[model samples]
Target: MSAEFLAELATLTDPAGILTGAATDGYLLDQRRRFAGRALAVARPRDTAEVAAMLALCHRHRVAVVPQGGNTSLCGGATPDSSGQALLLSLERFHGIDDIDADNNTITVAAGATLASVQAAARSAGRLFPADWAAAASCQIGGALATNAGGINVLRYGNMRNLVLGLEVVLADGTIWNGLRGLRKDNTGYDLKQLFVGSEGTLGIITRAVLRLYPAPTAHATALVPVAGPQAALELLHELQAAAGDRITSFELISAPCMALLAQHFPALPQPFAPIPDWLVLIELADAGEDSALQDKLAEVLFAQGLDEALLAQHASQSRAFWELRESIPEAQRLEGVSIKHDISVPLSAIPDFIEQCGRALLAAYPTAQIIAFGHLGDGNLHYNIFLPDHSAGVYAEEEHINAIIYREVAERRGSFSAEHGIGQLKRGLMQHYRSPVELALMRQIKQALDPHNLMNPGKFLPD
Candidate 1:
C-alpha cells in the first residue's frame, strides 16, 4: 500500500516521498500536549495541483486526511488521533501574496500565509487586514478561516467570517473549486465560497483566498479602564458604543485575580493596577480619519461611568504596557502549572451570573480550585479555566469530573461549550451529550454529503 500510494503521488507531485518521516516534529502535537497522535506520514504540498494529487491518492487508498497549518490549535482541532490511519497535510509552504486591486481594496493570498505576513503585506500596500489574533505570528490564514477565529478587533471589523470574500477549495474527490472572485456584489447561484469558511476543513481543502481590505487607521487611542464588575463593564461597553461607535475598536475585560496570577508568575513586569478591584476593561480606539478625536471620546465615556473607576493610558506605549498585562495572563497561567481550560461563552447579559455561579459551584466542590476567568467580554466570550492548587497528585486526573461540573452548568444556562475554539477530539462526547439530536443529525448529514468516505477529517467536530 505504501509503495503504491507513494509512487502514485510521486508521479503527480514533486518530492513524492515528502510524506515519509521526521517532518512533523512541531506540527504534529498541540499546544496543550494532551492529545498526541500518530499519522502515516506528513504530506507537504506547495501548490493546489499538488494538493489535488495528494488528496486523490489518499481518497483512493482509503486513508483519512488531517489538514494542518501552524499547528497552534488550542482545542486539538488540527492534530490527528493515535490511529495511524490518518495523514497530516501541511500547507505551510503555499505562502504567496498579490495586491490584486489597490483601488478596489482586495488582495489574494495562498491559504498558508501567516496572519502577520498578510497583515504586513497589507500595511506595505497602505491598507489594513483588520483581523488580529494573539497568535498572529504563527497562525496561518487557512487555519483562521477554517475555525472562523475571533480576536480582540472583532468588536468593529468582525470575525474571520466577515473578512473573507472568496475561497479556492479542493474537493474530497480532488476536484479544484476555484471560486476566487473579488466581486463585492454577486448574486450567483450558490455563493459557494462561504461553504468552506468555518467548515473546519471538512468540506474541502482551502488552497487560497481573496480577502477584503480597509484603509489603514491614521490614529490609535488606547485605554485600560477599571470597573467594579461585569455589570459595570457591560454598562461601560454600551456607553462607549453609543459615544464612539465604530471608532471604539476593541474593549476587553480582565479580572483582578488574573492580574494577580501574572504578577506571581512573571515578576519582571510590575503590577500596575491594584488587585482589589473586581473587573477591568481594556479599550482601544482607532480611526481612518486623521483628525478624528477618539481619545477625547473615550475619556468622556469613562468619566461618565459613575459606578466604575478607569485609568486610560496617557500614551500608546503605556496602553501597550497595560495590554501586556492581559496578554501575559494565559502564558503566566501556563507557566504556573497544569490547568483544565474551558473556552466557553454565554449571553452578554449572563456573563456575570455565569462567573459568579460557576465560581461558587467550584468552591463548593473544591475550595482550593482556582477559577481563572478572563476574555473578550465585549463580544460575550470568556476563558474560564480551572487551576488546582494541589498540583502534587492527580491534578490532570481530575479533568473529567471538573469538566462535568462546569459543562453541566453551561448546558443548564444554554451556553456554548466550545465558543471560539473548534471541537477537536477533546469535546467530542460532550457535544453529543449536550447538542440536540436534530442539530447533531444535520451536522452528520452535512458531513456525509461533503465527505462520504470520512476522509476529510475523520473524528474531530462531529461525535460518533
Candidate 2:
C-alpha cells in the first residue's frame, strides 16, 4: 500500500480511522485463531458514507478489501490472507439501530450492530429477533447475514437469510445499493439482496439490514430427554413435533461425550439426570400466549411414545439452566482440544443411519478417535466433530481423512458438507470437489459480475 493511498484512506474518517502495528493485532486474528494474516491497515469507517469512500479508494487502487464484522468466523472467513496486501475493512463503527417498525415487524440496523444488541432492541419493542448463536454478544449483523448463520432457532425462525427483508450493500465499486425495503411482498424484479446475504462478503459489503421480527413468546417450555440412540431420538422428535406441532422452537441432540465434557469442565452445573444418557435431546417450546400447554403437551407426547427418561424444566430458572448446558458444548469442546469439526446436515430421516454408519467407519479407520456429536436436530444439522486421543498428532495427520469419510457419507446421504457455517476459507476446497460444475460456474459468474476486479473479500466463499 502506498503512503498516498494510506493518507487518502486516513482522510476518509477522523483520527483513529486507520490502524496499524499493535492496533491491527486484534483485527488480524480471527476468533478461532486459525488464520493469522497481515493487513495494509485496519480501516474503521464511521458510517456508510465513509465505508463507500474507503471502498472507492481501494477499488481505484485495485487494493483487495476484506469486509470483516466481529471476526467471529469459525472458518477464518473474516481473517485476511498473510500476503500483507489486503486492506482490513472493519464495520465496527456502523453500529446503530436506525429504526424499529413494530407495525411492519421489522427492525433496520447498521451492519456493525451485534446480534445481542438487535435482540435487545426487538425485546424492548415487545418483539423477537430470533437469529441467535453462542457468539451473539460479539458477532455482528453483517457477519450473520454474510454467512446466513443458522442457530438453535433456525427450525422455527429460519436462518439470517430468511429473516432479512431488505439490505443496504456497498458494491465492489463503492456504489451504494440501497434495497432497504421493509416490505414483505416485493416481487417487482430480481432479489439482488440475496446475492450478498450468504456470499461471505466476497460479492459486496453488507452495511445494513432490515430483519424480520416475530411476536415475543410469552412462555417457554424446555426439557432434556435421554434416549437409547439416534433412532430413538428421531422417533421422539417425530412424536413431539406431532404432538406440539410448530410450537417446537428447538430440538438439539447431544452425544454422551458432550455431556461428559460438560460434566468434566463445568462441574458447578448440575447433572440433570443420574447416569448421563449416551444420547440426550434438549427440547424447547415457545408460544405467544402465557397459558400455552407446552409442558402438558410434552409430557403427553413423551408418555405416549414410551420415552420414560425425561427431565422437564419446571420454571424459568430451570429452563435457562437446561439451555445453558446446550450452549456450553462448543466451549467445552474447545477447552478439550483441537478436533476435526464438521457442520454438516442430512435429511431428518437419514440422521440415524448417517450417524451410525459414519461412527462405525471413523472408528474403524482411527480406533482411538472420539466422535463428540451434537447440533440442531430439528433442522438435521450435526456438529459431527472428531477428537483424536492425541489431538496434536491427529489434526495434521488425519483431518483430511476424517473429513473425507464424513463428507463422503454426507454426500451419499444427499447431505451438505457446510451446513450452518458458511464455506469460508476452511471449506472452499470442499466447495470445489462437492459443488457441481454448473453451480460453481454460476457462483463464479455472479462473483465476476458484482466484483469484476475480485477486490471484495478477495479469496473466500468462491474457489480460487
Candidate 3:
C-alpha cells in the first residue's frame, strides 16, 4: 500500500489513527496467535455502501484488500502476511436486523450480524435459524458464509450453504451482485449467489444475506451413549438413525481420551460412566412436536440393543450437563495447550474404520502422542487432533513429520483434509499435497479472473 492510497483510505473510513498505530493492535493477528502479519491498515466499514466504496477505491489503486467479517476466523483467514500490503477490511459495524420476512420463512440480515443474534431474532419470531458455531457469539454472518461453516446441527439442517437462500455481494471490481431473493424456487441462468458462499473472500465479499428458517423445535432429547469402538459405533448410528431418523439432530463421536482430558482439566464435570469406554457418541433428538417421550424411548432402545453400556442424561437439565462435557473438549484441550489439529471428513460408512485405523496408524508412528477425537459423526466430520505426550512439545515440534503422517492417511482414505475449518494460511501447503494439479490451476484461474491484480486476500487458501 502506497502513502497516497493510505491517506485516501484513512479519509474514507474515518477510523481512529488507522494510518498509524491501529495496525499494532490485536486485529491483525490470527486466532491462536500462531500467525501474525503487518496489515497496511484495518478499515471498519459502517454499511454496505461504504464497503463498496472502500473496495472500489482499493480496486482503482490496485491495493490488496482482505475482507474480514468478525476477525474470529479459526484458520488464519482473517490475518494478513508480513507484506503489509493487505488492508484488513472489517464489516462488524454494519450490523442490524434488516427485515423479518416471517411470511416468506426468511430473515434479511446485514453481513455483520453475529450468528448468535441472528439465531435469537429467529427465535423471537418463532422460527428456527439452525446455523450455529462455537464462535457463533463472535463470528459474523459474512464470515460464516465465506467459510460455508458446518456445526452441531448439520445432521438435520445441513451446512451454511444449504441454510442461505439468497445473498447480496460486492464483486472484485466493486460491482454489486444483488441476488437476494428470498424465494425457495427460482430457476435462473446460474445460481450465482452460491459462487460467493464458500469462496472465502477470494472471489468476493458477502455484504448481506437472506437466511432460510424452519418451525422452531420446542422439545429436545439428548443423551451420551458409551459404546465400544468403530464397529459398535456404526451399529449404534444405524440403530439410532433407524429409530429417530431425521429427529437424530446430532450424532457426535467422542473418544475416551477426550473424556479423560475433560476429567483431568474440568474436574467439576462428574463422570457418567463407571469405566470409560473406548468411545462415546453424544446424541440429541429434537422435534417441533409436543411429545417429550423421545428420550424415554431412546434410552429404552440403547438398553435393549446393548448398544450403550451406560446412558447419561435423561431430562433437559441432565441433557445440558452432558452436553457441557462434549462442548468443553476444545476448551480443555486449549487449557492443556496447543496441539496438531485435523478437521477431516471421510464417508459416513467409513467413519468407525477411519477412526480406528487412523488411531492405530498414529500410535504406530508417534507412540507417545495422545489422540483426541470427537465431532459431528452424522455428517462424517471428525475433529481428529493430537497432543504431545510431554508439556515441552505441546506447541512447537518437528510437526511437519506428524502432519504428513496424518494427511497422507486422510488422502489414502479419500477424505477431505479440511472438513469445516477452512484452508486458511496454515493448511495451504496441505491443500497443495491433497488437491490435484488441474483443480488447483482452475482455482488460480478463477482468482485471476475475479481479482486480476491479486489484491483481494491473496496468498491465502491458494498456493503462492
Candidate 4:
C-alpha cells in the first residue's frame, strides 16, 4: 500500500516534492524537539490543485495527512505520530505573495509565505502587515493563521484571526473552498474561514489567505521601564494607554530572572538595568506623524507616572536594541535548558494576582524551581515557564503536578490554559480537563463532519 501511494504521490508533483527515509527526518522533529515522529513520506505540494490532489489521494487511501507549514509549531501540532502510516503535507513549495492591494489594504499570499516575506512585501507597498513575532522570518502564513497567532502587536491590530479577510482551504476529499474575498464587512452567515483559523489544520489545509493590512506608521517610540511589580506595571500600562491611546503598540513584561538569563547567555547585548529591577515593561508606540512628537508624548507619560528611570530609545538603532532583548528570550531560555513552559492568559486585571498566586503555589511544590514569567502584559498572556533544578527532560516527569497547580489558578481566575499556542498533542489532554463536555462534543462533531475518515491531522486539536 505504501509503495502504491508513494508511486502516485511521486507522479502528482516533481520527484523533489516527495521526500522519504532520511530526507523526511527534518520535518519529523518539532521546534522544541520534544515530539519526534515518523511519516510514510513528506509531500510538498506546489499549489492548491496539487494540495487538493494529494489530500484526495490520502483520503482515498485512508491515510492520515499531517499538514505542516514552516515547522515552527512549539506545541508539536505539525509533527506526525509514531505510526509511520501518515503523509506529512509540507506547504514549503506554495510560498508566493500573489498580490498587495494598497487601496483595499489587503495582501493575498500563498499559505507557505513567511511572515517576514509578507511584512517586507507590505512595507514595499507602503502598507503594514502587523502580525509579527520572533519566528516571523520562518513561520509561514498558513501556520500562523492555523494557530490564530497573537504577537506583540495584538493589542492594537488583533490576532491573526482578526487580520484574516478570507482563506482558501483544501478539504479532506479534494474539495477546495475559496472564500478569498478582501471585504472588510461581510454580513454573511457562518464566517467559515474562522473555523479553519486556529483549528490547527484538523479540519482542512489552508492554501492561501487574504489578510488585512494597515497604513505604515512613520513615527515610532520604544522604552524599557523598570516597574516595582506586576501591579505597578499594570498601573503604568493603564496610564500609557490613557495618554497614548491606540498608539501604544507593545507592552511586554520582563521578569528579573529573564534579565539574569539574558545577561548570562547574551552578554554582548546591552543590559540597561543596573541591578535589574524585579520587573520591567518594554513599551512601544507608533503613529503617522514624526518620531520626536511620539517620543515626547511617551516620555511625558512616563515622567507623569513617576517612572523616572525609563530607558527610552532615542533612535532606530536603540529601538532595535530594546526589541532584541525581548525577542531573544526564548533562545536564551533554550540555552539555559529544559523547563515546563505554559502560555496562559487571564484578564488584564487578574494578571498580578495570577502571577503572585501561581508563583507561590509552584514554589511551594518545587522549592528549587526557578520561575521565568514574562510575555505580553498588555493582553494578559504570559509565557510562564518553570526551570527545575534538573534542567533536563526528567523535569517533565513533574509536568502533570505542576500543570495542575498552575491551571487550577488560571481556571479560578477565568483564564485560559492555552493562550496563543494551539493545543497540539502536548495540550490535547488538557482540553478534556479544561473544556466542558459540550464544547468538546461540538468540536468532535465538526471534525466528524469535515473529515469523517479522520485523515486530516488525526490525534491533534481534538481528543478521541
Q: Which ten residues in a row have the lowest lDDT in candidate 4?
A: 455-464
RMSD of 2: 1.1
Q: Worst ten-residue run, lDDT, model 2?
A: 390-399
TM-scores for all predictions: 0.95, 0.98, 0.95, 0.99
| Candidate 2, 242-308: lDDT as tens digits | 7778888899999999999999999999898878888899998998666347778888888787777
Instruction: Count residue pairs with overlapping backbones in model 3.
Output: 0
Q: Which stretches in model 4 have alpha-carbon errors above 4 Å?
A: none
Off by over 4 Å in 1: 16-19, 290-292, 307-309
In order, what is each prediction's RMSD in angstroms? 2.0, 1.1, 1.8, 0.7
lDDT of 4 by residue, 197-226 (tens): 999999999999999999999999999999
TM-score of 1: 0.95
lDDT of each: 0.82, 0.90, 0.83, 0.95
Clashes of each: 0, 0, 0, 0
Q: Compared with the true structure, what per-residue lDDT tens digits does model 3 show for residues 135-225? A: 8899999999998899999999999999999999987788888988998889978898887877889888899999998888877877778
Model 1 Cα lDDT, one tens digit per residue, 80-192: 88877788888988888955577888889998999999999999999999988679898999999998888888888888888888889998888998888888899978878
lDDT of 3 at 464: 77
Question: By descending TM-score, how would the candidates be arranged?
Answer: 4, 2, 3, 1
Candidate 3 local accuracy as lDDT? 0.83
Better of 1 and 2 by TM-score: 2
Backbone clash pairs for candidate 1 read none
Candidate 2 Cα deviation (angstroms), residue 26: 0.5
Off by over 4 Å in 3: 15-24, 307-309, 393-396
Question: Where is model 3 poorest over a 10-residue stretch in terms of lDDT?
Answer: 15-24
